[model samples]
Target: MKDIITNIIFWVVGAIVLTVEFTFKFNDTLGWLLTTIGVILIGIGFIYKSKKPFKYLIEFFINFF
Candidate 1:
């Protein structure tokens, strides 16, 4: 399913971005950039009606912010 694949991609990307942000102790600008992108991808996944993964991502995003 296209939706499944898309959500998976977004989920993976978001996870990677957040991981890099936390692991590197980089500048705030880079941190914010990654955070913003991760949030946007998760938000798009929600908009596109991704199911369980999206639900979990939404919960993570909520707690993340």
Candidate 2:
């Protein structure tokens, strides 16, 4: 149940980020911020089973940098 809820939240956040990205014209810094967040959420969703979302989140940070 907890995993399900976590995945749902991640999906919702990712969806919102994508919608905002498409619906508005943000400046480069804000755009990169949103994109980074969206990607982190997605990557976390993909690797949530091992309690390693933080690891995946850091991976996203590395990639974005």
Candidate 2 per-residue lDDT, tens place, 1-65, comes to 88878887887898789679868958789988988888788666666774675777788789989
Number of the predicted model whose TM-score against the real structure is largest: 2
Candidate 1: worst-modelled 10 consecutive residues by lDDT? 45-54
- Write candidate 1's Cα lDDT for 1-65 as tens digits: 88778767876787787787789867878878988887787666555554565667678779999
Off by over 4 Å in 2: 50-65
Worst 10 residues of 2 by lDDT: 42-51
Instruction: Write down the lDDT of every candidate, Cα atoms only.
Output: 0.74, 0.78
Q: After superposition, how far is residue 5 of candidate 1 from its true place, in Å?
A: 0.9
Task: Tell me the number of clashing residue pairs for each predicted model.
Answer: 0, 0
Clashing pairs in 2: none
Model 2: lDDT of residue 4: 73
Instruction: Candidate 1: list runs displaced more than 4 Å.
Output: 49-65
